[model samples]
Target: MKKLILVRHAKSSWEHQVTDHERPLNERGFQDANLVSNNLNLDGLKPDLILCSDSVRTITTASIFTSNLNIDESKVIFKPELYDFTGGNLVNAIKNCDDTVGSIMLFGHNHAITSFVNTYGHIYIDNVPTCGVVVIGFLINKWKDLNKGKTIKTVFPRDLRSSIHSR
Candidate 1:
C-alpha cells in the first residue's frame, strides 16, 4: 500500500506586509504545527518523502513538523507548483512523484488540499483545518496507479483530540 499524507499549511500571519507567498506562520500556527507533529508521532505514520510548497508559511509548517519529529530535512523537496489552489494541479504534482517512494507527505495550501482529499477519499470532512494532516492509503503499489476512492485512512487534528479523549 502506498501512503499519501496531505498537510495543509499552518495559519499564516497577516501582520507582515508582504505577498501571500512570503507570509510567515503565526504563533498559533507554530503551536498547531507542533500539535500536528505530535499527533503523527503518536500515530506512528512516517513518510519517506516530503513534498512542500515553496511558500514561506508552508515551508515553515513543514520545517516545524519535521524538526519536532526528528525527520531528516534532506528528504523534503520544495516545489512552487504546490501553491496551486485547484485539486487538478495538486493531483498532477502527486502523480509526478518518484514511484520508488513508498510513503509521501505533501504540504500545501487549500482549497487544493481539501479538494484533493475530498476527490480521492470517501470521508466527509467539512474542512481541513490549518496544520491538518490526512493520511490516505492507495491500493496500488505504484504512484502512477493512484485513483479516487483508494484512501484507507483519513486522520485530522480534531480526530486525534477526540480519540485521546475517548481513551
Candidate 2:
C-alpha cells in the first residue's frame, strides 16, 4: 500500500519584486502552515518520505510541517520537477519516487496539486487552497503502479478556523 499526501504551497508574498520561484511565504502563510502542522501531528499523520519543490515558497511550506513532525532531513528531497504547476509534473515526481518508501508527502504548486488529487482520488476537490493537506491512499505496493485508490482526508487551513477575512 501507498499513501500520498499533497500539500499546496502556502500563500506567498507578491510584495517582493522577485521571480515566482524566489517568492517567499507571507506572514499568514507561516501561521497557516503551523496551524495545519499542529493538526496533522494530532492526527498522527507521518510520512516515510517527503518530496518537496525546490522553489522558495514550496520549500518553506514543507519545512514548517516537517519541523513540527521532526521528520529527518534525509527523508526530505527538494526536486526541481515539483516546481511546476502541472499534474503531469507532479505525477512524474511520484513515479520516480523510491519504491521502498510506503508513504510520501508532496509539497508543490496548486492547480497541479488540486488536479492530481481530483484525478487520482475518489473524492472531488474543487480547489486545493494554499497550505491545504490532501491525503490519498493507494492499494498498490509499488508507487509506479499506483492508480485511483481512495480519498483518506483533506485538511484545509480555513477548515481549521484559521481563515483570514479580508478588510
Candidate 3:
C-alpha cells in the first residue's frame, strides 16, 4: 500500500502587498501548521518523501512542519507544477513520484487539493482549511498504480479535534 499526505499551504499574510506566490505565512498559519505537525507526530505518521510547491507560503509551511517533525530538508522536492490550481496537475505530480517511496507528502494550494481529495478520498469534507493535512491510503502497492476512489484513510485538523475530545 502507498500512503499519501496532502497538505494545504498555511494561512498567508496580505500585509506585504506581495503576489500570492510570494506571500509568507501569517502568525496564525505558523501556529496552525505546528499544531497539525504536532498532531501528526502524536499519531506516528511520517513521510519518506515531501513534495512541495515552490511558492513561498507553501515552502515556508512545509519547512516549518518538517522541522517540527525532525525530517531532513534534503528529502523534499520543490516543484513548480505543484503550484498549479487544477487537480489533474496535482495527480500527475503524485503519479511521477519515485516508486521506492512508501509514504509521500504533498504541500500545495487548493481548489486543487480540495478537488483531488473530494474526487479520490472515501470521506466527504466541506473544505480543506489552511494548514489542513489529509492522509490517504491507497491499496495499490506502487505509486504509479494510484487511481480515483482508492483512499483508505482521510483525516484533517477538525477530525483530530473530535478524536481528542472523544478520548
- Identify the candidate with maximal TM-score: 2
| lDDT by residue (tens digit), candidate 2, 20-66 | 99999999999999988877742565688899999999999988988
In TM-score terms, candidate 1 sits at 0.89
Model 1, which residues run further than 4 Å from truth? 150-155, 158-167
The CA lDDT of each predicted structure is: 0.84, 0.88, 0.84
Least accurate stretch of 10 residues (summed lDDT) in model 2? 158-167
lDDT of 1 by residue, 37-112 (tens): 8767526766889999999999999999889888899999998988898877778878888888988989999999
lDDT of 3: 0.84
Per-candidate clashes come to 0, 0, 0
Q: How accurate is candidate 2 locally (lDDT)?
A: 0.88
Candidate 3 lDDT over 56-119, as tens digits, reads: 9999999988898888999999999898887777999888888889888999999999888888
Which wins on lDDT, candidate 2 or candidate 3?
2
* Deviation in Å, model 1, residue 162 alpha carbon: 7.4
Give the lDDT of residue 128 in candidate 1: 86
* TM-score, every prediction: 0.89, 0.93, 0.88
